[model samples]
Target: MTASTAQDAVTAGFIVIGDEILSGRTKDTNTGFLADYLTAIGIDLSEVRVVPDETDRIVEAVNALRERYTYVFTSGGIGPTHDDITADSIAAAFGVTIDVDPRARAILEAHYPPGGLTAARLRMARIPAGADLIDNPVSKAPGFRIGNVHVMAGVPSIMQAMVDAIAPTLKTGRKMLSRHVDADIPESRLAERIGEIQAKFPETLIGSYPRTSDGRFTTQIVIRARDEDILEQATAAVQDAVSITLA
Candidate 1:
């Protein structure tokens, strides 16, 4: 099945664009934020890809993901430097002309003084031909949504603002409910039984995370499902399989 056409009815893809993230010069904290945000709001963040500040790669990844998911959110490469090529790459990906958007320009102009709006800063005003802007309250430079894709700033705070701005525009599905069980048994000991529970409850997603603290190895089993009853069933199955306390 295609990425968008997968079992989940509501899904999203994330594209992290920047050489900094690829080179490990800047740690990527936005992806996790997006995942948590999307998950909380009933959207599954199903796919994620990190690309450098290369135009062709950005264009390729954007095109592929836009076709594959219900929505594609791109972070980074929308800054005011020579390396901020996301806007141009996205325009190329949609086969549209890139030009200074008057609306975006107005926002940037309002944010910066006349002399402060340098040519480099104006670069953030460039938007694809057919797209609506996603507001950025943190930094006046706005992000835009084209087709199924929503582009946003790479900075954690700004990207989060853009996401909030775009949330109302999306078609959200049923919210996913999560239950975490702190199991006294080690992950290896409960692996087989958890596999059985997963097979028995196919609609829910179950994951076991192991951690060792104070020389004790324990596992945290997380159960996620849209239906509370099903989530309870999954939780009960895991609890019956091993000794666990609700978290």
Candidate 2:
């Protein structure tokens, strides 16, 4: 995905790679962040998968997603420790050789002290063949981009930095718009009406989520679409139905 060209639609998938995430030892935040970010930029976050630190699993997941989506992002398992197998796994997926690139090594060398760039720390410099580095501003240890797959750090701060760095370079489509209307009634009261409204505007996605306020029952009807006219029509219909029920 390049910055110059706009597409009719753009789609993305995310792979959260870590054993700690599956083990419940670490909570996953990257998926939610990517979902919201992609939507804001007019890209559909169509799918997501979580895989462990195992190289084979990561390779399989990466290959599948990269082929399916316009872009695939993987977060986690790219650290200096022994278990950080993401780079190796991603390289294996692309049938590339993994080696410490001089550019990456230089960055790490500059970040650490004269003698602090140990063999373990140098592991962060490994890049798959023909891949470009994704700038990591928070920590100097950079992430990398291979083909349509971007490999990022697991830490939220570092990951966010990487995302910001790459956001401007991605192609985008028309942004999806959304709005919500509140009803002073339970979801059951609006259920049938919602079905009718949805049927009327099949192009728009309508959903009802019940909410409680000050001991009163209510439902929040959310309507989303790229077409503002259709969205407005659905919103008005929903409001009228709720008002009539109250009357």
Candidate 3:
């Protein structure tokens, strides 16, 4: 669904590309970081996708998500490795040629001289036309941005630094408000009561997270809303329904 670009709401989507991730060899860390960071900055993460390192797949995902969401962030497969085809796929998605962009080349040349610029390293400089370079503080090889997609390194630390660098450029909306209350109750017993409270507070979203560790059933009911008053009301209703005093 297309999210409203109103003054109070922001929407974002993420694209993760790599064969390692698709094959379950590498667990994704960027998505959780992006979700938490963007939520704190008032950008709702509407969708996330993980695709294999294939040109056609990447191009299709980029085109679809870029048009659907206000901002799109991609991680993985931008390195100097042989399977790193993110830049070319991104160029194809935007219907442009992959070339040694002067700005990108200048950025790289300052770090790696002509003789030092191997084919693998030069692969990082081949950005699409009219794209801006994203600063990667962890590595000399920079990520590039085109349209709504902000491409970054797959490594967690580097991706986080890139995110910090680009956050200021985005127009963030009002932050989404949230409240949570935990109780030592089972989900099967709490589900009906929680449903009742949710129906009463239509604007608030209620979620029940049940965890059974150490042979104890612990449940957490979280209330999420765009409005503070509604969140407060829903939280109170949940507490009342569950018969626990929330701290």
* Residue-level lDDT tens digits of model 3 in 8-53: 6777889999999988888998899999999999998999999999
| Deviating ranges (above 4 Å) for candidate 2 | 1-7, 214-216
lDDT of candidate 3 at residue 226, scale 0 to 100: 82
The weakest ten consecutive residues by lDDT in model 1 span: 1-10
lDDT of 2 by residue, 99-195 (tens): 9999999999999989999999999999999999999999999999999999999999899999999998898877778989988889998899899
TM-score, one value per model: 0.90, 0.90, 0.90
lDDT of 2 at 12: 88
Give each model's whole-structure lDDT: 0.89, 0.90, 0.86
| Inter-residue clash pairs, candidate 2 | none
Flag regions of model 1 displaced more than 4 Å.
1-8, 243-247
Give the Cα-based TM-score of candidate 2 against the true structure. Answer: 0.90
Cα miss at 184, model 2 (Å)? 1.9
